[model samples]
Target: MDLPQSQLVAAHVQECNFVQIIEGLVDSSHLGFLHIDTLRKSDSSDLAYAQNVNSMQHALAPKIGVEDTAFGFYYAALRDIRKEGESRLQARVAGFIAPFTVLNPNGDLHQLVIPMTDTRSMFIHVYSASRRRSTRSRYAVSTCGWWAWTARHCSDFT
Candidate 1:
């Protein structure tokens, strides 16, 4: 859904909040460590995961081309899952930490973190996706698991 541009502009003007900077620090390498235990054992980082990343990068390079600059890391690795089929699905825990926006600028099923203040933050995350399930179903199952995982491991965030 498109945010009414007017609302975004208003938020920027009112000092309700301004400026959102997104940093992409996690990659396949980091995923292995960050999600190893949290994710299902079959989904953990391994030779399969690296190959998946490489395959995705290769597929996306032709369509979107490759951007090899400072801003490019964010766009890197756009995989084509159709080739992989239904064996295992890969998902990113992405987040949009914004000053005011409630919904993620990037759809659901990725980790979305919104920071309200320096020390305090609100996190909305998507845990997984499945070809077998509808969007709503995938989100419900994944979100619950994600919330439970975060509550147990991420004490600092609380």
Candidate 2:
């Protein structure tokens, strides 16, 4: 877990269950809904965050593609976007390690789920990310806070 390019400048902890936290991590579809204000479509000019509209609005349904890897599997979430009058595809890739670890293809973000007890869990996240270029979640604040907060336990699913 050593990246010469980056070092731990700081760290913190937040309130979330081990199961629910991972659930939210893999459930990329909720970005449009859960993070509507943040991840939702912004404008036509920004091609980096384009959208694929359907009958209702910009559709965020990603075409998930997975490939087996030595560690586990790597996956790509491809989304169609429109520019001018043409349609194009944008892909975001990420990889998972067995047990509970996820890495962004860019190598800028990493998250691990560590269970503290039956009800509390710790999300140890590392990022060498720039705010302007990185896609951060609203939940990021909690993942880096030291306060002893607790989220509803959803470990029953495990």
Candidate 3:
């Protein structure tokens, strides 16, 4: 399946090794705590990404399960959702493609970590939408807030 609409949302040099970037990508537990303020302030009605952020905030200690894939590995962050007195489980699965690529659970976002030197790496974020969807729509930009937050807070990001 080819995505007709795509954007290179962010390309920045991070003051970290590629391995460190990859480690951060696979660690889902950090999302709730590290981005608690932004996630809490997020408009949950905006898009699936916002909703997912809200979910992460609600469930900080999600059960993580990992499986080895042919190329690398995939992991699922399972969280318990209680709504209207009913309980359900929400699983967000993401993949780590060797040697430094992360596949977001939504399947539309991807992060690539390219090593620049011994202690530096290039971090790239890409967002893509299918032909049936408009790239300018809110859905495509759902994660822009997170990227913006990173850019604002990380001095090394540019």
**Which candidate achieves the best lDDT against the true structure?**
3
Candidate 3 RMSD computed on C-alpha atoms after optimal superposition onto the true structure: 6.8
The parts of candidate 2 lying over 4 Å away from their true place are 1-10, 41-57, 130-158
Q: Which candidate, 1 or 3, has the higher lDDT?
A: 3
**Candidate numbers sorted by TM-score from highest down:** 3, 2, 1
Clashes of each: 5, 0, 0
Query: All models: lDDT?
Result: 0.31, 0.57, 0.71
lDDT of 1 by residue, 41-149 (tens): 4444464333334333323222222233333222332334454454333343322233322222123234334455553334443323221122332222222233222
Span of 10 residues, lowest total lDDT, candidate 2? 48-57
Better of 2 and 3 by TM-score: 3
Q: Pick the candidate with the highest TM-score.
A: 3
Q: Which window of 10 residues has the lowest lDDT sum in candidate 3?
A: 140-149
Q: Which stretches of candidate 1 lie over 4 Å from their true place?
A: 1-26, 38-40, 43-73, 77-111, 126-152, 155-158
Model 3 residue 96 distance off true place after TM-score fit, in angstroms: 0.7
TM-score of 1: 0.31
